[model samples]
Target: MSNFKRASLIFLLAFLALPLAGFGCKQGDLEALRQLKEPVVLQWWGVFDDTDSLKDIIASYRALHPNVAIEYRKLRFEEYEQALLKGWAEGKGPDILFIHNTWVGAYEPRLTPLPPALTLPQLIDPQKGVEKSAAEFRETRTLTAQDIKNNFVPPVRDDVVRNNAVYGLPLSVDTVVLFYNRQLLDQAKLTSPPATWSEVKDAVKALTIQNTDGALLQSGINLGGSANNNRAPDLLSLLMLQTGTTMVNPEGRATFNERLSLDGQAFSPGADALRFYTDFARPTKEVYTWNADLPEAQELFAAGRLGLFLGYAYQLPYLRAQGPKVDIGVAPVPHLNTDATDAGRKQVNFANYWIAAVAKQAENPAVAWDFVLFATRPEQATAYLDRVKRPPALRSLIPRYQNDPDLAPFTAQLFTAQTWYRGKQPAGMDAAFRAMIDAAVDGTRTPEDAVGFGAEQVNQTL
Candidate 1:
């Protein structure tokens, strides 16, 4: 349709939807709808999801408010950011968008914080004798900061809340889990996956296969450097967190390069984590099964050459499709050993997921935010999680998936799962980490020096 016709039709829609599911609304609710007297169209964009996954929820929401119409578009993740940037520059960006949880701070300037209250449709007054009767709605203060903290996991509050206001909300959360080949473990005489990093080291010895010439015939695990493994950053960060390394200080500066007192001795856990990780790739170390010469971690794991692969829950379907014949089993990501030598340490894991947020460009931000609340609430979110086969972020929904073979490990870890790196330069931060991993694995610099240098690089982005 031409621009003029579109504009005229929208004008008519605004007037026709005057009831807007508020025919029996109170005075205040009617006042709230004054600005919304115009047609409210919400354009939502997301990545790695299909329209069918959301069609039912959208239909349910639309059925409540005839005045509001939501149009959802799924974009390729690789091209999503550039598309958003370009469209935003032209004032044509989506009013609603799905962004990685870590991107909250970077994308905050373009987002609108949730309002204190929302005037929403509560019910539709349908009378068989009075066919013209419209729907009814009420104002609600159910989307408070405290409400978010109570309803969702701790990491959701950590990532989505700014100074005091909430900038976004999530429907699901995923954590890194140990994906191991059952056949490989049985061959190595191991009956179960490792429960601690120390066990992982010993298991690597039995699972590794090498010839007298010192050439690797098959690898035990995928770890060490970041060159070919896309998950290298998450794995390394997870290790750092588990070792009690503070990723960023209160001032938002990188502090993973600093030191702390361990057993009355001053040492840098960050550096220790880095050295421990690089040991797997060094020929001199006992856990020397991985090196730069090996194929990408995902590739090696799929071919059954790799014994254990640390990955997020979202990757399970892809791994299954890639290695259809590979018998895969999942276990909780190994934690710091809770033995006599290491006691009272916290259980830490890595979180990687996307969130739903409203744009500042939204013509009616209240309406946009209302949809966000409706979509993330328990009922709608549960339906979404059911369709997606991922872990739910809501505490109430955890039990439903507690026994699910593929989802249990991820859901169980949500209590302590965390994330760092909230800056705008996600790509630059990845490059700095890759460089740090290379220096330590290549013996070009000490692990401590490399970590310090990487921290400085990340500071520039802040």
Candidate 2:
């Protein structure tokens, strides 16, 4: 071959390889990022909230980055997981999605952990008498794991942060609080709500009214039995935690039924908690108030036949809709006051909420996570919380909502809210918890035996 022809072929090969070599280093180059500055669209999918609820937050983000477009879609809670699975399997899932806190462990593999910081270009200064941007500059914002821990509530750290990486962040966190009948308490001559388990027992005994033939005329507190009780697992979890049970260990093993107390007591707190929970359903117990034959707890409470029911923020609307004139009052969950000085005996409410996360397979993961970070900021989060009227997850905003009469009880519990690890199959673990309570309540097994059985079953799921 001629020398000139050979040289021409080599030049052609070099030209093709130039772009391939540049690809490896382009990600860190600001000029390369600025070159690909076309509008990028993101699809966001969520559950239990309509797009209108997030419209203001979305607009706030858009004002920061005009070139980014977000399309928000709301999915039904019952059908959300299957739809997400199908979409992801087909390589067409959302760039951002809402994940329940309990399911974070199961969904971690599909979610993109936020980076240490984000760098994006934004308009810096507008010309005088002009509404258009005159200058643009890159802005860098950083969020460390410590920042998340310091800014958000305790359970958010426990649920969202894994291995020093944040899996997601929530706009709000809801906790289970006591909902009691005002007229029933007034009828019983009790003006104040119960503040401790012993007080609850006393109140229940006073409020419960049984007819001559042993039929329950008015139930005390709708607890103990699993089937009819609302949020029975969460209630039981709160009991276990307050009684000094570690629901799961760092290794993701179910150790709730077998742990010693924080003071190193040689007793199973889970067993004790379970017994305390199921006592109200036992016929022989003085605290007996509910049974398996009773109607659903919410229905009974709404109909004004029940005294107290434990529920979260979401249950308020349902209860109001069911019986507007029921005259209900909300309070913090009662604690175990066996030792007043023992901080561990304080009230521990259950934290449950949805967190927004970026999909690992997202075309622009950085931008997706950036949007999430932007939305969860204090201002944007406040707007979202105002629309939802749920509990605030941020520590700074808790005090502001504390003065709100309707939200005070929930907001007060946010600092102390806790949740147990339910593993990959959270629903199945909760079912085991319910079964444990039911078995103990029915006298099929002793509390100790039931707790051990439930722990063993929950460990399998983990």
Candidate 3:
């Protein structure tokens, strides 16, 4: 029999022998089975920065179940997608896996549907919420309906739930925040960071400085970051969210070119957002800040050369490590417009989540699920968040982090956090979007043309 069949048989035999042991079996009989000198190694693949933390988790798990062993592998973010696809095709992949929130939709069919016994509702009550002093989000013991109702925040919950079923547990949450150099604002005579996009634009213009030779002395904002494969797409996604244009329709289809038209003219929000982004590099714009060969945008911001950058909460650790001397302040990504009416929906921010799922070919689904539950439980979740200094996905942890001076603004924006998804063709959609942006930036295509082309490419892929 195959490995899977053998594992299934072992579990079945264990269950069948339970009553027999109670009737007549001795302690040594059970001990002999438990101590069976056979290796039962499970494979796990994930993206994690700290290997020691993962090892600690694995060690803790192994302590609880001494019979089972795990071989853990870490894949870099950039390499994970292709690696996973190749592994899946060969039916030789990790038994458990970590997938990005946006990837769930594409990979759902490939993953095992968490057993009904593990349903969230059976695990926790939705109305009651998790019972904790601060209403901390905790992982449910089972994937029951109650677990779904109580633990997960909406929209985020929506991402992992397909066809009214939960497939994975959220691991870490991230949202975009503004990182500004205090000295730069002070040098420009600014009293505080901008609250609205218009204010931000004005501030950028004021802070940007150049010598007579036209070489930039300092830039107000580092508009193009290599992280996230350059910030143009992320910036556009944020803009689309702000403009109240859902890039995908309710049917989960691309709507960029179809639904978003400004004043009867076909407006490519994607192109417009890109143009606005690259405009910062123009000599007359607020900042001329792009070089083929330069340190990363975050590094420039940390080095005090750039006044502002869009970064996630995780970047704080790196900033502290790389440039402790720079006076840095965090704020919400500036709103398109700040008004009382916009209170509930002012700025558009992007939120990202990491999800853990069981592979369809997993030899021990029950065991994998149990470990996932233990790792994502409230106490453990909080511990991971504390280690990474990232915001938690649980609703209750929001207030605790909100009180944090550095983390408050970011946590506050979680309510308005919008996510991006490329449906079944993420790579294709991303490529098309990037091509359109490049065309618009290079002046080869107008914003309208770029958006139209992007829509066509996306539609073709769909």
Tens digit of lDDT per residue, candidate 3, span 365-459?
Answer: 77778777777767777777766777777776777788878778777877667786667766677688767766655668876777778877877
Report RMSD for candidate 3.
Answer: 10.1
The CA lDDT at 307 in model 2 is: 91
**Against the true structure, whose TM-score is highest?**
1
lDDT of 2 by residue, 255-327 (tens): 8878464556678888989999999999899989998788999999989999988888877878889988899
Candidate 2 residue-pair clash tally: 0
Determine which window of 10 residues in candidate 3 has minimal summed lDDT: 129-138
Residue pairs with colliding backbones in model 2 are: none
Task: Determine which window of 10 residues in candidate 2 has minimal summed lDDT.
Answer: 126-135
Q: What is the Cα-based TM-score of model 3?
A: 0.79
Q: What lDDT would each prediction earn against the true structure? A: 0.84, 0.85, 0.69
Candidate 2, overall lDDT?
0.85
lDDT of 1 by residue, 1-462 (tens): 999999999999998788864554555444444433446789999997788888777888877666689999999989999999998899989999999987887899999999888765433343321234433456778466787889998888888888889998898999999999999999999978988888999889989998898887787778886887887878888888888888899999999999888679999988999998888889988899987778888888888899999998778888899999999999988877843112246788789999999999887787889888899888898888888889989999999999998899999989888898658877777788888889999999899999999999988886
